[model samples]
Target: MNAIVTMDALTVDTGVRDLRAADHLLHTLAAELALPEDAFGCTHLVRGDRPRVALSLAFPSEPLLRTAQERLTARGYEVTPGVPDPMGRAVLYPGVSSLTGTLTIAELLSRSAIARVTVLGSPGQPAPDTELVTRDHVRPHWHDGELVLTAMPAVGGTLVPFEVPDPTPCCADH
Candidate 1:
């Protein structure tokens, strides 16, 4: 959300095995805890030795962090009191909901907490008038210490998020 900075972070491991479930759990926990606008909900992948998806929620202050930890602990999650290595993809952040539908590149930057939108395979940013078809799913990540969205050119010269909501299965046609 608002400029993902280096902050005291906590890891929430709910034993969710996949990204979709992890995202749901993150939203659920945030709602249950009444997370503040600046609070960040990130998803991490835990590989090997009990592979599963882990979540991280970082608040703007230590008091909020403590409160979240206490609440998550009360909910019976294995809450670790620190951030995981390679802070995972953000599933919940400030102004995330406003990114749905189609938005101009300028409107996207002005309206949402996302700091930058980088088009795939391009060294330059998309034009302000470029339409971004959000498709009801816009998930940005912390890149180079900034909250950035990666998009690719689509039909009609519009752009779409690099990661779609529903991806084709690896062997679906078989």
Candidate 2:
């Protein structure tokens, strides 16, 4: 993904896949830049060999944006300057820690806008249960099948940022 940092926002031109796969990276970057949890959002861009997703995140100031660009560029990401949309959805940063003990599917829904949960492997496979424990980081993984959500520890409970899988094709969009 190529990142574009400007005075007011951070834009990422993600190749092939949408911003869903890069949620963790975005969250990490936001944390590193000290950006507020609600300062980020994404929009779909039609380009390249696949979907060119643009993730635009707001920074507190121009200096912070420049700092983030420099830091991300130093970390090997392609950084540049570009305009970002101001109408993106607010990104929720579920920290790398749990907020409570065990939780049910109902509880998870109450916490975020997660519509469904399943395991990895096939596209439509279900996890067979709605019970989950917490751990360090809770992130989603995309597979050929359904998107699987997993975390560390596999018990207790953590605050997982709820995200929906992008239905766009990975590459060579058919």
Candidate 3:
């Protein structure tokens, strides 16, 4: 993954096959950096090798941007300082706790911009009729045999992987 930090935002471009992992990383970073929920945004990019995804967070100040850069860099990420687009979309973080419970689709959407939700083994599948979700550190897990809501991390939230124990391996070849 490639990360760019500016005075206004932190953007991450990931090439991992699993979108869940990418979203987790983005959200985790935001929480670690103490960014606000409204600062997060996510989008899928078209790529040939694997599933490419881009996640970003708008920093409220230059100090926050520098702090986030330093933190990510210390964690081995090559954070580059750049100029972010003024009109880029802002993604809001969902304030879901890391507890087990049920949430409706509307409630989830009101808190996050989760691009998609699917079953554990089924990728690209739409959410079920009930649209109920279970939260585990903002990483939506399957609730009562239903679908899992995949969302990018917002401020005050962290990412928890559902399947992959570690997602760094997928980026090694890059």
Best by lDDT: 1
CA lDDT, candidate 2, residue 138: 41
**How far does residue 20 in candidate 1 sit from its true spot (Å)?**
0.6
Task: Write one digit per residue (lDDT tens) for candidate 2, span 99-142.
Answer: 24556645654554333455333356233344655332344432
| Deviating ranges (above 4 Å) for candidate 1 | 1-5
> Could you give candidate 1's per-residue lDDT for residues 100-140 as a string of tens digits?
88999999898877888999999999999999999988888
Write down the TM-score for model 3: 0.42
RMSD, candidate 1, Å: 2.1
TM-score of each: 0.91, 0.43, 0.42
| Candidate 2, position 136, lDDT | 26
**Against the hidden true structure, what lDDT does model 1 obtain?**
0.85
| Candidate 2 residue pairs in clash (backbone atoms < 3 Å) | 98-158, 122-145, 122-146, 123-145, 123-146, 134-156, 134-157, 134-158
Off by over 4 Å in 2: 1-7, 14-16, 41-43, 84-87, 92-174
Whole-model lDDT for model 2 versus the true structure? 0.47
RMSD of each: 2.1, 10.3, 10.8
How badly does each model clash, as a count of residue pairs?
A: 0, 8, 3
